[model samples]
Target chain A: MASLKDRIGVIKLNQKVAKDIYKMVLQFDDMPDDIKGGQFAHVKLNDKSHILRRPFCICDYDISAKTITLCYAVVGDGTKVLSSYEVGEKLQVMLPLGNGFTPDKNVKKVVLLGGGMGSAVLPAIPTSNPELEYYTYLGFANKEKVVLEEEMAKVSKQLTVATDDGSYGKKGFVTNILAEDMAKLKPDVVFCCGPEVMYKALKKALEPFDVPIIVSLEARMGCGIGACLVCNCKVKRAGEEETYVRVCVEGPVMKLSEVVL
Target chain B: MSNLKVNIAGVEFKNPIITASGTFGFGREYDRFYNIEELGGICTKGLTIKPKLGNPPPRIAESYGGMLNSVGLQNPGVDHYLQKDDLYLAKRDVVVIANVAGSTLDDYIAIAEKINGSKSDMVELNISCPNVKEGGMAFGVLPQSVERVTSAVKKACPNKPIITKLSPNVACIADNAKAAEAGGADAISLINTLSGMAVNYKTRKPILFNNNGGMSGPCVKPVALKMVWDCYNAVKIPIIGLGGITSYTDVLEFMICGARAVQVGTYNFNNPYGARDIAKDLATYVEENNMDINDLVGTLILNK
Candidate 1:
């Protein structure tokens, strides 16, 4: 449930973490039980001029601090407003929207694949419980496009990096690395989030793998609720029939087999 | 204080401000943000006899001043609504207006029968949606069919106030309004979203999956006002004006142009508190000008 009054929560700009990414931490006084990964928040900028709330995915949350971080790219008019705020400046944000990834307890090994901006959210799952053996595979166009390598390295058991231009670790692609290491490491589950092109490539490459796979899709959402069926994904349900369910409600995360890329 | 009450075909409202159909979904979402009882009324989502999955992806596209939507009347069906939706809206204090759509005459009759026995305040017969392929445009575009459907629904739901929502896409809105009136409609709501399309320049393809969608928001204001005025002159019953109403200024413009009341639609996307804001502004405007808000009704002056 969401409302215009609760459309934005008072937030304080904590720090400027990286280029194009600001870490605005909000005080969740009576925060909802769980702010799951892959779920998003709608932040309103400029109480008067802009009426619509802009959507963003949660980067990290600290219960002790009563704060959650939103890492965003400065792309459009809304982001321009978000980028102009200063430290300690009061901001408004709606929280923990959409569905998050379902982490399995029985899994022994985990592989998290992210490309470019998608890397912002990968740290949460690994840092939540450090006992699990986690590996990260990061895909970037070149060295300049890479982000959060050090932060990703801190949580995962091993960090594997790849760039298309061979400006970093592996010269080829993450899919090639995934193909090579599919047997020895034998990850029980694969969680991937990235651009459409990268996800499409992974969709084809990971078809034969026996492990359960989950994909986080990105679509232009209007309401960020079930009412506006704008953010819909074609899903192949059981019985070989296909139908569309809202990405904002049913998921931003679903089983790879259930979705049509 | 200025007699905010309004009764259309016997269904009385505390005020004249209402959350338009498709904009406010059965009052649950909007209720979470504010007290829904403050408003005059609400129109539930367009209902059909059977569950409709709606159109495909890219169902909505952002235009310069507004948006184009082709969300093909997606709903859980009339039976489910009567069985479950009534319980949700029953607790709310505002007048309930059920907007019903259909693919056939029987579909309309079945939904009307459901509304006949329900707690809904008014039955707004929506034969005006331009996005759907079937009964939406078919029943609305032709005056003969409009009269037929309105008559049929009036017969089915004898007790309910029947407000036939008119499409702006038709040749003459005034003639169509008269047709609804002749067919036994107690009231009328004008200017449903205008049919329009947006093209993706780079891809040389339409932005929406349906190729065309209903244009709404600030862009359609003038067109809506004209239709409201046109229909106002031709009909004796109250006209519920709608189309691209974002601000109180727009609401005033509609009232002055001869609308008894108005519905706020696409503006809900940009501002969820749009209806309340408009209500406040309208009250202020009425007070500042020292003119009766009701007197603003049918004040349109047509130049020959």
Candidate 2:
């Protein structure tokens, strides 16, 4: 019912922002104006050696410039290949994919949380939902691995950065700091994106707070749309049987309580 | 003037490009990308009598020049399809092919019977899926089982043509193709994904949760062409060749290797418009060359 096509995007800027993390700015001539936070872009490399397109979260976007920023970590060959490219190279990029984060009518004060590179999914939340108040907390292994803190800070009403070994920002986990802040601020909702282990930590840290927690998920994707069943996430809603929904389609975003994790 | 039409089991197709099963879903997901009627036909995902949830993620892994998928035949039951996608596809001008899979003869027969009266123009019997743990690839590896499953499904769904899909993981794919032909299949499709695994060196565990998956993409083209050529010389029925077909030239290669028509797989994920793009490209090539598209089928001249 939704007719869209894979678009050719020009790489405007590609630069390393942190340790092993690169922020790529892609300029689409016809970028979808409806792009939101937590949605992703499936980018195909110009090389033929890799068949699957690597998916990245829409870290940020500039509507007036028709450009979107993608933040990725060079963890594997696909991302490694992506980091090698420079400006002016054109790639097949399918943007604004998957369902993005949307705050409900009553949601006002929202706490934005990120762990390490998962902070890439945060900045766009404020860009799209600018009306809501955002209190952000970001955690990285150390300062070298930290990214998007400045972009996140500019938009966030208050920004807190943490490192496990205290290389920079506050020492210890961001989840613990968020729990302390949650007690004082009492935000209406908490939105997070991070490694699975961080989610385990956040759930425990925010247990005393009675706010709805939403999260963005990650999966090994094939078709960044729902057509291929490879990118599935297990979802178990209240009183419903455990079922799988495509993370690329049903979500990169879902209610934390409903997720099987 | 060039002709792009192809006839498989007496069913006429406007073009030689069909989107392969499993990769194309029910065609709705792609309808958002392009008009479904632009292609020759559409093959639905592998279906069963009952709904299947399929394997867990990470069910997919990227390899050199291709990708591995262990989707495990996830599909809504035939009943759900008949009530939903069947009606939707029947409304379109394109040919609808329902790919049915089962773990046993009874499972095959039941699903085939259910699809017989549906809107699908043909039934693709998926005996070669390597991901399922049960009766899937079991019936595809041997000539006898291939024949047995083909004939039983044919007996149940006698009204429409049956295309027995062959797997490349078998001992002899040509023999299996012959077995399918002899069992009264009107046509056949090959080769399903090759059985393979992608391992993470750091973890020493397979990337896929299922530990194995069927591999498809441009890298599998050579193997698929050889198998298609072997099956072309072995069987008389029409063959719908597919394995790593991406561009129009790839379609020509498969046709020259004895494919009556070609199906675009994995490439659909590379670009949602991949199937339509290939079809358009092939149509342009045929028109510019001024030759019938069917004239290239089985036309390969091997080196002596």
Candidate 3:
């Protein structure tokens, strides 16, 4: 079973990786064996004043070392508070949450796409499914906002990084870059995580391709275990009325076609 | 003489800690963390006459010490709950209270009558759902409306005890409690989420998609305890106190302030094992003290 109970994780490393972004690796006493990529960890800061626990994608994990890394941006008071914590300080973290990305048995080749902080979700996919071949494309606003390019490259068969401005690699959206390369790459399936806007763009851009597109969604969550219906996203499949599914339960990852953008 | 049990409206609970409605969804989600049977009782997610789709995305937002949510009471209609979760909860060792909601009096009666045939031990009326009748006022806001709905549902589901869950967004919460009692309600639960909102200064927009949401967490405990005391003094029926209860001491505070029992809400979001852990802590405290937990009810020593 997944680790459903809260576990204390001592901060092993907490440092800035990019502008407004900090990557913190938490060392736990032990963890469950079945943690998959695309799953998230709900983190509670030390003080009880901040009642809601912030949900962060399990960017990567080292089961042998009993550590899960969380990559987050200083968006508000909760994250700013998270950034100030020092090494050896502990946070209450519930890991291996939500239904993670699990491709079909026959699937072999894969395409990984990330946009900025969403790239944090890509590295763990390869760690979980090391047998599958991966081609990666990453997008960021500019050089200052880019993150996890190096981490993603290690897991991908081939990697492409682009920034909106000419300040970095390519000078346009990564989705457009991937669209240009779709026929040549010809991967079995595509997995992406980015802002909601990116999902819409990817849906339209990849409409020509026959490949299945899966995307991870982010929502303001309460009770990341699905008890509280706070983290809901709408999904509409063929011949079905639109229904809200808990991002914390049915998914943080869902098929792009099914998610009502 | 260690007794952690409490009786509310003739329903005997194993303990005084019931997971609040809307927080515990038919006891399925939290059961994965710990055996939910360990808690005293569970007020299930609010059920409507038909399945409610609720509000759009971004239904939740965070504050300094609390959170705001505009879930719009999205639930798989009463028939769905009866067909699915009711069977699952029937086997649990815990007391199951089916929380029902509706947009009108007919809706409340129809849903209550449906739940009366189910396996739930009690019914909690979540009158916080906005009503279209009477100038779009919520059923829980006005004392007259509280009594009207409570009595109708009480008669409709005569087999089950009725707990009119009051909204704290109203004036004179005590009068509402009295209204529930007058409507022949067996018990009353107070106070539901306080009406509030969280905003974004830069965008000049509200964080929730619904533009407004209900606030709950550790911050609302003071407001909840005061209301519980007010209602306890005003009504003869049992009162189930809730709001931002995070610890066993918070449970004790509710009981001392005249709550027959207390419910743990938002803290369940913080720790999945929160409600069960609190029940365990309360048991240990009572065991160590060798006292009956019920003795603490209405024992607050108010200074002159």
Reference interface contacts recovered per candidate: 0.31, 0.89, 0.81
Alpha carbon lDDT at B125, candidate 2? 94
Error of 1 at B304 (Å): 11
In model 1, the runs with Cα more than 4 Å from the true position are: A1-33, A44-53, A62-68, A73-92, A127-133, A239-241, B276-295, B299-304
Q: Model 2, DockQ value? A: 0.86
Assess the local accuracy of residue A102 in candidate 1 as a C-alpha lDDT between 0 and 100.
67
Task: lDDT winner between 1 and 3, please give it.
Answer: 3
Number of backbone collisions per candidate, in order? 2, 0, 0
**For residues A84-164, what per-residue lDDT tens digits would candidate 3 score against the true structure?**
999999888888888788989988989999998999898889989999999999999999998998888888889999999
What interface RMSD does each of the candidate structures achieve? 3.4, 0.9, 1.7
Model 3 misses residue B163 by how many Å? Answer: 0.9
lDDT of 3 by residue, B1-304 (tens): 7999899888899998899988888887788788888999999999988888888868888876788888888888999999999999989888899999887789888998999999999999988643222211378888999899899999999999999898888889999999999998999998888778788999999988888888889998899999999998999899999999988999999999999898998899888888999999999999999999989999999999
Residue clash pairs of candidate 1: A9-A93, B258-B298
Docking quality tier of candidate 3? medium
Runs in model 3 deviating more than 4 A are A1-3, B130-137
> Could you give candidate 2's per-residue lDDT for residues A159-223 as a string of tens digits?
99999999999999999988887778989889999999988888888887788999999999888
| True-vs-predicted CA distance for residue B156, candidate 2, Å | 0.4
Kindly give the stretch of ten consecutive residues in candidate 1 chain B with the minimal lDDT sum.
B1-10
Worst 10 residues of 2 chain A by lDDT: A1-10
* Chain B global fold similarity (TM-score) for predicted model 2 against the true chain B: 0.99
lDDT score for residue A216 of model 3: 94
